[model samples]
Target: MSTPLDATAIETIQGFDAEKRYKHLVKEVVANRKIWILIDEHGCVMLNTDDEDCVPVWPNKEFAEAWATGEWDNCKAESISLNKWHSRWTHGLEDDELAIVVFPIQDQEGLVIYPDELDYELKNQAKKQR
Candidate 1:
């Protein structure tokens, strides 16, 4: 049986186009154990989970740059255990935002890379090509 938290999380994701993390939770082929945590380019983890929906607050060029280079230290004062990458993004509102946490699809060589971090690096690299 699904808990109330699970149901609400699914509902929230359904309402948004991009922020919705649980958009595919109901599909028969969905991966139930998979979890994603949102983060900003600065490597500051956001406050939402894969099961929730969040609206991007604004676009930060610096934030984008940080993610691209895997420079999380600029955004976070404390050291982050997950060295792969992490991020922080504001919701449209001044105080609201979302973070999507993602883990490796499969553990590679016992090293777990955060999806948010990996995405930033990949995206950052792509941006440079253009």
Candidate 2:
């Protein structure tokens, strides 16, 4: 059975008039720089990095639902646009690392994590391994 749309999903759909509008936003943001929005099988959202595996991104709810059933482990996927995602969560990030923000339905305050100190820490780890 298809999952019912929640408040966030409804707001996201209404925010963009059509799928084309959503695609246009994605294209516009991606034109400036590569952007990735990471969303798990649940509603949790994060900012994906270049080093991570490719995650599916759907322009609208219909597409997300279709993919969610057969391919995405039967879990509903909710995503925010790159700009909206950045605006909502980027303020919490430190200058040195990639940020992962988790938005849970019950909680008003989202959790933010900087996985590593970006290039500096990763490079140091690499050097130590060599």
Candidate-wise lDDT, in order: 0.29, 0.39
Candidate 1 achieves a global lDDT of 0.29
Off by over 4 Å in 1: 1-110
Per-residue error for 80 in candidate 1, Å, reads 28
lDDT of 1 by residue, 16-98 (tens): 44322222321211222112232456443433334543321111122223233343334422222222222322112223333
- lDDT digits (tens) for residues 1-130 of candidate 2: 2344577865564455433343432443344322333355564333354553223343334544544433444466465544453454344344433453222111122233343322233234335445
lDDT of 1 at 121: 47
Error of 1 at 99 (Å): 13
